[model samples]
Target: MRNSIARRSLLKKTLTGLGCAAVMLLSPLSLQIAHAAAPEKDELKLGFIKLTDMAPLAIAYEKGYFEDEGLYVTLEAQANWKVLLDRVITGELDGAHMLAGQPLGATIGFGTKADVVTAFSMDLNGNGITVSNAVWEEMKKHVPMENGKPVHPIKADALKPVIEQYKAQGKPFNLGMVFPVSTHNYELRYWLAAGGINPGYYAPAKGDIAGTLSADALLSVTPPPQMPSTMEAGTIDGYCVGEPWNQQAVFKGIGVPVITDYEIWKNNPEKVFGVSKAWAEANPETHKRLIKALIRAAMWLDENNNANRQEAVDILSRPEYVGADAKVIANSMTGTFEYEKGDKREVPDFNVFFRYNATYPYYSDAIWYLTQMRRWGQVGEAKPDSWYFDVAKQVYLPEIYKSAAAELVAEGKAKAEDFPPASDDGFRAPTNEFIDGLTYDGRQPNAYINQFKIGLKPDSLL
Candidate 1:
């Protein structure tokens, strides 16, 4: 790995030197426009997990968007989310493709206390909940069928009876999520709780971070890439994870994906491009340039009505990136998702990168994650709505995102219409698109938390 990184560095420097020399001769005005500001740190290493949503980083590197911005970036796949976050905090990694909740979780001292911030929201709605074959068989019995096919958006209601049976049989029902603060964890818990199953709670104040207090189904962290095999090994009955892993389960015939996060909440934000607060402070220009490159990559991913998805799948399938089979990655990337075997369905928004202003780091997106953290007892005490807003503003740097996006629009690389309006505030309009049909107004996070039937209510202590 070290040798390969060295070679990549050498090649990037050689190519960048040659490209700069050629561009300098064309026009001084053009050169001034192109070279943003000799990057504070041109050569940098960014980290990612081997999930399909890491496409922005991969696409940025592969399409030379990084080079276009005078940034020499090496995309290194990390062992897992924790390692990836730790590296970014410790300055071993300049930045990383991170879970949207990671920065919030880290900043609030959920797992690791660090001042991590994100200027780029990576993608939206790219995860699914999968159950092992045995659980699927049992769930199939309860699931509503239409024309001999299981209905769409298979609710956790179908999995409730299975958990009951596991308890009756003296078997501990186990489920997996990528990380404690991951959207997968919250989405899985949300689905399970909506169906009247107690997924569990956290009591950090009591020094019990296990998150399995009085639970019907035991939830644990499993790395994204190992989710399928972990289930195959009988360690977890089901899992909520991002794409390719859920699809891998279908291909391996070990499990069946029941529903996607998109079905749970429409166009939900997933991952972000994250850096330490200190890193962003020191490399403001570099950070803006990085976001600029990522914005372009995101537009490319969803451009022309997803005409480039096939190419993205191919690029992601390479060993250096996602390393999954092209067919498995394509199962969800190309505007469709496979549920049960041969149950291919059109889910055009499954892996959104740029459409619907997905890349913008909305403050509402940050607040939603904070609400989930509080709902599950990660935040031991209740916080005011003002506190939520302050934390969201602190962690999600939309000004940086807006600056990068405005530059893109000014350069004619992107359209003003493609972005959120200049007068728009950082919050999206209140949405009630969740599966349970609960309305979420970022301005009223505490009220939203109080509405959840499960989870810790306001003034309720774990």
Candidate 2:
């Protein structure tokens, strides 16, 4: 781990050449994540998309979290989410900052056939849907405004009238999401549907993965980094993406961010750190150590009312990290977010990586992804509630997270109170923070699914 940390640090220094800025901010006594111990693999490679949520992996490597555990890591930016998952599957990369559904979808053969697992969730609520300034102006008429601001939790209800205008005029209303199984895709769909807009569906059984079945707005996959270009090219009107792409839109003067997922559903789960299940089984101790470092990194990220966010924005701006311009990344990396060109608002929970147990690999989080898959017809078939649990168990490795947190507590690097009780069940208690105000109990997935007006029904199939 020491060698890996040292090597990653050197690589970051070479890539960033960031000068006194990095040196001045290097944390003292703040980087220790675990007791010095033997690491199974000294040199490792990890994969990531160029999104801001990838911060934990970057910070863990740059801050020497891997070294404290005696591991050396290489962070590589993948071209796309699928490529990142493939790299992990083919052992081209050791692990990746992954989509929460990538591991579960892979495990169930929904997209790619492989066994993937996640021990750590990377972040929460770093995603937003943005429209071009032109579109925002038109949609503004339908949106309810009060106190000189758009109402809280802006729904696609406002966008529906705008899309209708395009449709009535025989123009296409195109939108982009990062990937089919990405949280961005599901969140965008959920937002669009809550307002009576059909974003479309997938019918894997019918050999249609384009997800354009009976859609009003055409949804397509655009890599996170390409979202701005795609939108600016008039190829896509808007997109749902993670920072700094949303922030990039504002900086480029090309678009306006309407609402963040945090506003859609408070503190919603986002990305996860995923690896092939085979890799996890082959290096159990190493996997636990990796999760420990990530958990610590997440804790540092959200600590002290996000006091570290400014420094974090600078780190993410470095070419070796998120690599966007500092101002672009800082648009949201700091506590405030940019909506319209100048409507900046304070939204501290927009990128919660750790606080509120955000880093914990809760079974409920995995279950939510499965529900989305079914909702969009990616599942194609329905199963009992237990199937949701069984699938969630396959991808979300909370046991690994618990073991790592326990080790940290034993070493006094972390406290027992920082984690759920040792006897803790994997599921969180029921939650009702959804846009529709429907409660969700992970244990009763069937009942939860029934609450949705949109999506697959029991025993339904394409």
Candidate 3:
């Protein structure tokens, strides 16, 4: 088996090198435009958790997109988010897949004070909140039904009665999210708060980062892959996690996914490809090539309306990658999601990678995460709108993303129309697509934070 694997690996690398050579020979002008600068560092080790959104990294590695830009990347599966971030900070890993909020959170000294930054948004709308079988049984009683099946976008309102029952019985209602600064934590909080449940706050200023102060539902950290087994062991009643784990619950008959982040906030930013600011500055050419490779991978994932998702599922199922059954990964990756055991529904944008310009590192996306941090008290205090914008601009580097997209366009690997325009200003148009129906304008982040009913109020501290 070792010899066979080595032979195949050698063959794959040889073919990849030949492919790059062919591209250069066929289009010398394109090569000149794309590779104006040789990568500052050619070999890299990138980190990721075993989730589907890591697909871009996997696709780039597997599809030779990385080598196409003179990058040799080794994608490593991280034990958890903290370990992943720590490794990146220490320079043990060149970069890694990260939560959309991670770079911003680190920059603002929320969890760990580090100058992390991201030019590539890995994916969008790939997470769901799941409940244990018992919780789902009780929640079903309150959920609206259509034709004897549970209605879609099941709000946390249905979950409220169940929590009340737990409270009346004096049983502690516990839930799990991947990390405090993760999209999972914020989405779970957003959903609960929208339904009048206090998911609680983080008074990091007081050294109480537990985030469960006066909470109806106490949410703690559970790594993505462990979400299913951890809930099955009865340690957590439910969890909000990214793909394969949520579907794994359904496959194991242990839990039911209630609502995806897509319902909580449509096309919400999920993960990002992040590196330290020092690494990016020292290796600017290599950084752009990394982003260029990721951009190509994302385009392929969403190309032709996700025509390549099944193949992506196959790639992700490898033991070195997500290591989940293809069936479980496909449950969400193939344009549909399973709620109940058999209640699969069409949700084409469930795991978007490239569509809707998903790879663009928008400052509005960064500000939204910051708003969540402030709302949950992780930021500890209110600041001027200028502070939010400055933090966002510092962490989410749109200029790097645009430079990469420009390279791809020049090389004919992607189109000029495939990226945000030069005048995008890094903010998405103001949107009210949240579950609570509150408007959020990135330009007016403090105003957006004040509109929340269950979060920290203006000038309030825990």
Q: Which one is best on lDDT?
A: 1
What is the TM-score (0 to 1) of candidate 3? 0.95
lDDT of 3 by residue, 1-462 (tens): 234335546755775679867665756675565547778898788999999999999889878888777777777889999999999999999999999888888999988899999999999899999999999999999999989999887899999999999999999899999999999999999999999999988998788999998899999999899999999999999999999899999999999999999999999989999999999999999999999999999999999989999999998998999999999999999999999999999999999999888999999999999889989899898788999999998999999999899878876789999988898899899888989889989999889988988999757878
Clashing pairs for predicted structure model 1, backbone only: none
RMSD of 3: 2.7
Q: After superposition, how far is residue 94 of candidate 1 from its true place, in Å?
A: 0.3
The weakest ten consecutive residues by lDDT in model 2 span: 29-38
What are the Cα lDDT values of the candidates? 0.93, 0.85, 0.91
lDDT of 1 at 307: 99
- Once model 3 is optimally superposed onto the true structure by TM-score, how far is the C-alpha of residue 62 displaced, in angstroms? 1.0
Against the true structure, candidate 1 reaches a TM-score of 0.96
Residue-level lDDT of model 2, residues 1-462, one tens digit each, is 346556666765563586556546656543333224445676789998888999998788778787667567878889999889989999999999998889888988888999999989888888999998889899888888888788767889899999999999999899999889989899999899888898888998889999989898999999999999889999999999999999888888999899999877788999999888888888887888898888888888878888888888888887777789988887787778988778889987888888778888999999988888888898888888989999998888888999899878876778788888888788888888878788888888878777777766756777
TM-score of each: 0.96, 0.92, 0.95
Error of 3 at 438 (Å): 0.8
**Count of residue pairs whose backbone atoms collide, per candidate:** 0, 4, 0
* Tens-digit per-residue lDDT, 107-164, candidate 1: 9999899999999999999999999999999999999999999998888899999999
